[model samples]
Target: MKNTKKLYYLIGILVLVLLVWMVNDTFTQPGVDDLEMEFQEVAVYRNENNTGPIKRIYAVVVSDTLWHEMEQYGKLMPHTKYGNTQVYFFEDIANAPEKINAQSPYFDASLNPFCIGKYEKKAMGEEHFSKYPFR
Candidate 1:
């Protein structure tokens, strides 16, 4: 009887630990609004192929050039296994692309000069980020 009681106590302690962990995880996670910089999403694209690798792209206009925050925004984007994700940042919505795709040279070359930053997550899960002085 004593051993059974001890086992029950242990199980109860584990349940309490799990509940605390869950609540902590839920509240500590960051969302889009958690970003310190002001930004607007101008465009988004997804290949929408469930049978194969998915591809996602985003174009955003940011009020300022904050490289770390831009990277954080990219990380917040949805990604899938064996998939790719890319983000392009600009200073003005007028220069940001209204449409993007999985194709190479995702956006028009003419807009390159207006891009302020770029972030990419390759299919193999590799990440790349760069900031341009195109302001």
Candidate 2:
């Protein structure tokens, strides 16, 4: 009788644990949340045929001059000579990881062509952003 009782208790514990795990799996899967969350608005160019639905967002940086040039062009002009610029755009900047700004060696920290003066920052929403040649 004692062995039977112990078996039943163990089974009950296992069932409880399984139930909790199922609840967690159901609630925490990626893209399953129904909550309305905030997203920074920005723009990007993407081909649905080549890339899947995964949206690449960014923190865009450009110069005031570039801004004016883009305004004149009436759209973004992509330039590939300088490579892709790095601007930090986070979903939650408050809890974002530490980043090496222009002052860091990773950014070359030079004040010449690719310096901070030629940069402006903006959040690229849930879209792929293109690099435009700044006038």
Candidate 3:
């Protein structure tokens, strides 16, 4: 009878340990709270600067890589900064340059180093309309 009671106690202990482990695992699991934090951080940074009516601007098509060109241009021009710039990806500027023009106020500028030849393309930044011409 004593040995049987010991076996029952052992089983109870094992079950209790398992329950505790499962509870711990569930509590530690990632939840919506983590994602909410990331979104909140993004919102905070975007609204930090209260400036002019945020312009919806698009950049011209370039022959070389899109990111490399945007980075170079952003460094040179204040408006081209990542937060302010919106790039439009195009296969060839000549093929659909009109599409860029149709979208919004677009600046006609090519990547400075044109000798590198054609490569992949990408666009960055949000789209906004200008109250006046891009100039």
TM-score-wise, the better of 1 and 2 is 1
* TM-score order of candidates, top first: 1, 3, 2
Better of 2 and 3 by TM-score: 3
Write down the lDDT that model 1 would get: 0.89
Model 1 ranges with Cα > 4 A deviation = 2-7, 133-135
Please, what are the lDDT tens digits per residue for candidate 2 over residues 1-135? Answer: 999999999999999999999999998764412223323323333223323222221232322334333222222322222233333223333333233432223322221233212222223322132343121
What TM-score would every model get versus the actual structure? 0.85, 0.26, 0.28
Candidate 2 runs further than 4 Å off: 25-39, 44-46, 50-135
* TM value for model 3: 0.28
- Each model's backbone clash number: 0, 7, 2
Q: Give the per-residue lDDT of model 1 (tens digit) for 24-59.
A: 999999988998999898988888699899998889
Per-residue CA lDDT of model 3 for 2-54, tens digit only, reads: 99999999999999999999999998964423331111110001123445433
Q: Clashes in model 3: which pairs?
A: 56-128, 56-129
